[model samples]
Target: MELTLAQEKALNALVYFAERIKPLYLTKAIKLLYMADEQAIRDTGVPITWLDYKAWRFGPVPEDVYNKVKQVDNLQKLDAGDGVLYSLKVSDAPADLPEGLVLNPIRPFNDDEFSDYEIEILQKVIDRYGKLTSEQLVDILHQEGTLWHRVVQANNLKQQFELKSNRSDYIIEFTDLLDTDYKKAAFEVAYQSHLMQQNLM
Candidate 1:
């Protein structure tokens, strides 16, 4: 597919960053792509997605386009989770990691404010669904035009389970760490920071 000017710019930026800072987390790489796309949209008023760039703009890229981009750029993939239960190699690393695996520090969002209505919505989802996937939560919030807010809330939901599947059956259970108010707060802060940084960029 033809590359939009915005898509080209975002891909180029992603490649540039990938080369400079080999990330350990695919989500971080995806986040970088999203950030670049967000920035491109902010600058040029064009919207793009990883799927769009991979299938349309970049032209016949690999199924794992983000990972392929990292490989082509000579960046190493490291242990990371896909925010779901399964373990997957991530392409970005936190700044504090060992040498030769340096990654750009993720910027924290300045705004930590959440409206009462937002919190209420989150409580409602937790009350209704108990534990839910991020994608599922996103679908629910999309209807209300508050997908972003729910993304923040899902991140804030303290209880996390590592999903396991066997024979095409799936089970959701708690992770090793017990849920606590502190963890929930940290998740909220991180989620908000991620959202704000992406939106800002």
Candidate 2:
């Protein structure tokens, strides 16, 4: 949540401008502020995404100010290869955020929150599919009766498609589901049930 000096300056400028400008012109005002503080703005190196010269007319900011005010606005338009951009509004700023600076306000996936089964399944899917979309993998798993079964199947598919296809000696890599944690508590119940059926054996 620590903010760089440039972030602090930019945020303060935003706050100052927000107080005096008509609600419709806040976006334009921010851009102008950035222009006035060109060096500070440039230091951010975040590309402008949306240029709403008229957002303030609505009065009271939208809940998704960070997203609406992003240097890059339409996230869907960004190339997938581009690194993920983090964003946050002043209200959403973390307490630990430095004075004058706001956290970009993005959330990160917690790896520790994942269950062993989910990890195993996800890893298998990635290895096999190389880069299948999350939706595609989810659909495939849904068809397998149990979620774990779907994960196992997706994993199996990846192994068959990647390893087995490339090397005649390749064997399916089995996961010890009993020893692993699930990303969600629900996964544990499902995993244990699957194990009881000797499916994991």
Report, for every candidate in turn, its global Cα lDDT versus the true structure.
Answer: 0.33, 0.32
Error of 1 at 24 (Å): 7.4
Model 2, span 12-36: residue lDDT tens = 3343343333231333434333233
CA error at residue 99 for candidate 2, angstroms: 29
Q: Estimate each model's TM-score.
A: 0.27, 0.21
Number of the top-ranking candidate, with TM-score as the measure? 1
Best by lDDT: 1
Against the true structure, candidate 1 has what lDDT? 0.33
The lowest-lDDT stretch of 10 consecutive residues in candidate 2 is 51-60
Error of 1 at 16 (Å): 1.4
Error of 2 at 118 (Å): 53
